[model samples]
Target: MKKTLGIIGGMGPEASEVFYLKLTQATKAEKDQDHLNILLWSHADIPDRTASIEAGKTEELWAIMAKDVQMLKDCGCDYLAVPCNTSHVFQDRFNTMMGGHFISMIDEAAACAKTVGTTIGVLGTDGTRMNDLYGKALRRNGCTCVYPDKEDQEGVMHIIYDQIKKGQRGDLSLFLNICSHMKAKGCDAVILACTELSVLKNNYAELSDPWYLDAMDALVKTCVTTCGGIYQGNL
Candidate 1:
């Protein structure tokens, strides 16, 4: 039997939608009722995660996220996940407060990367990048971490916020250039640490695997297996 899943989302509404659709695609189901019961709070009004981290509004972000957790709890979910990678800077605190399991997409991504290569490159928002969130996690998993240079970092932010978040197809070359930079730097594998980038990955079937891993897909597989459901993996 599959346990109920809770999604604390809306860090960017587009990312939340991608997460749900992928979750559905990743699940093994024969009937409409076979899907895990998911309680999604796609609250678009929550403070922007990157902005909150940059502006020192951690408390405001936490308070609002806490309400989302409580609301999910009220819905009786057994496992919880937040689709936004940038928002995971507070994952440790959330794990403590969660009534059940709070799956860490960051950790899952790192683990997935470790299996793919010895040196991994991560791409995410400034909040996540500056904090070295994936860096710490990837190191712990016994993989070396590589990151985009300053100009490439700005390009990453642009693809996420200026394009994908705006529901635009986001400049593919912008992302590919960042990837090329990582590969040039000896990155054997690259993680799309941002959910918005996962959107790009989903749209572009040409992005080869093992060379690239989607953190959102890791979350989907983990959520499925952790909740006692079979995963129909696309990874």
Candidate 2:
């Protein structure tokens, strides 16, 4: 029996759409029915994760996400995927609420990074950086995680919010410059830990450099595998 995959998305709607498209493109489907069953809840109204985290008031945020989890469960989803990286800071709470049905995007990315190299760079929002979501997971899997310097990190935020999230084409030069900075810091690979960055991965052809592992891609692969579907590779 094939399982159903649930998505708790719309932390930003664009990233959620990317995740869905990747799933469709990755599945080895010759017919419509061959694709895996998916239940998506695109709730764009969830409070800003970075702002909530920075303010030290995540209780309301947690409540909103927990409600989403319950809705997925009620909808008969077998496993859950959240596209937003910063939202994984509530993994423990989600585990408790969902009883281990959540599939972690960070864990999947860390596993992939472990195969490629020992040192990796992480690029994401202030909330994801301050929480060390990728850093802790990669380190636990025996890899060293590097972060952008203060200036570059701010630039990362600008690329995600000011450009990609606003539906503008991101500055490829800015994105590559940060990747080059990570390479200069001795990182063998970089994880695009933000879903908004994942949007960049889908939209920009320039990201084909192979040095970046996108969190959304990781989640798509996991969703396919968990639902007992074969991944035909990115389309």
Candidate 3:
């Protein structure tokens, strides 16, 4: 029997769907039965995480996520995953609210990094940076996390918010520019801590060096593994 995957999405509608499509593509099974069962609540009404963090609306956002988690649990989802990086900020409380079995994007990303080295760079929203969410987790596991300065965080956030979230393929020039900056700062690899970064794989080659890690890819990998298969990257 296959386990049903529950997703709490619509932080931006497109990114949530991207995870589903990637998961289906990642499955190794040749037939429909081979693919993992999936159940998702693409609740676009959930308050925005970034907005709450920036505008002091955390209560509103957390309330919405808490309610969404309950909705998924009520739907009988065996295991749950949240694709958004910043949303993990409320994970602990949300886990309690949702009744646990939550798949963590940050924890998985950190484990992937720890296997290769001692330090890595994280690129994501101002909220993600301000909290050093992924960075702190990596450090707990003996991995150091390097984040961009305030201005750089703002730059990356703008690209994610203004461009990618709005459904525009982010300008590769700007993405590469950030990559180059991270490389210059001695980061061995870059973790696209934001799910919105999925748009970059459209143009960039993985072999372009300075290993580009996608958190969404790691999440998909985790989903496949949890559902009983090894996921080969569609990139």
| Winner by lDDT | 2
Predicted structure 1, TM vs. truth? 0.96
Q: In candidate 2, which residue pairs get closer than 3 Å at backbone N, Cα or C atoms, i.e. clash?
A: none
- Candidate 1 local Cα displacement, residue 3, angstroms: 1.1
Deviation in Å, model 1, residue 210 alpha carbon = 3.4
Q: lDDT tens digits, residues 1-235, model 3?
A: 5667789888678888888888988888777778887887888887678778989888888877877777777888778899889999987876676566677889888888777677699988878877789988899889889998767777788888898888787777777777788889888788888888775564457524437878887789888888666577643
Work out the TM-score per prediction: 0.96, 0.97, 0.92
Off by over 4 Å in 2: none
Report the Cα lDDT for residue 66, model 3. 79
For candidate 1, write residues 1-235 as lDDT tens digits.
Answer: 7788989888778888989998888889999776778898888898888899999999899998988888888889877899999889889877887853899999999988888788999898999997899999999999998889999999999999898888898888778878898999999888899999988787777774658788998999999888877789865
Candidate 2 minimal-lDDT segment of 10 residues: 226-235
Candidate lDDT values, in order:
0.87, 0.88, 0.80
Model 2 agreement with the true structure over 1-235: per-residue lDDT tens digits: 6799888888799888888888999999888988999998999999899999999889988988988998999989888888899999998777677678788999999988988899999999999999899889999999999999999999999999899878887888988998898999999889999999888877788886668888778778888987888888741
lDDT of 2 at 217: 83
Better of 1 and 2 by lDDT: 2
Q: Is candidate 1 or candidate 3 better by TM-score?
A: 1
Worst 10 residues of 3 by lDDT: 201-210
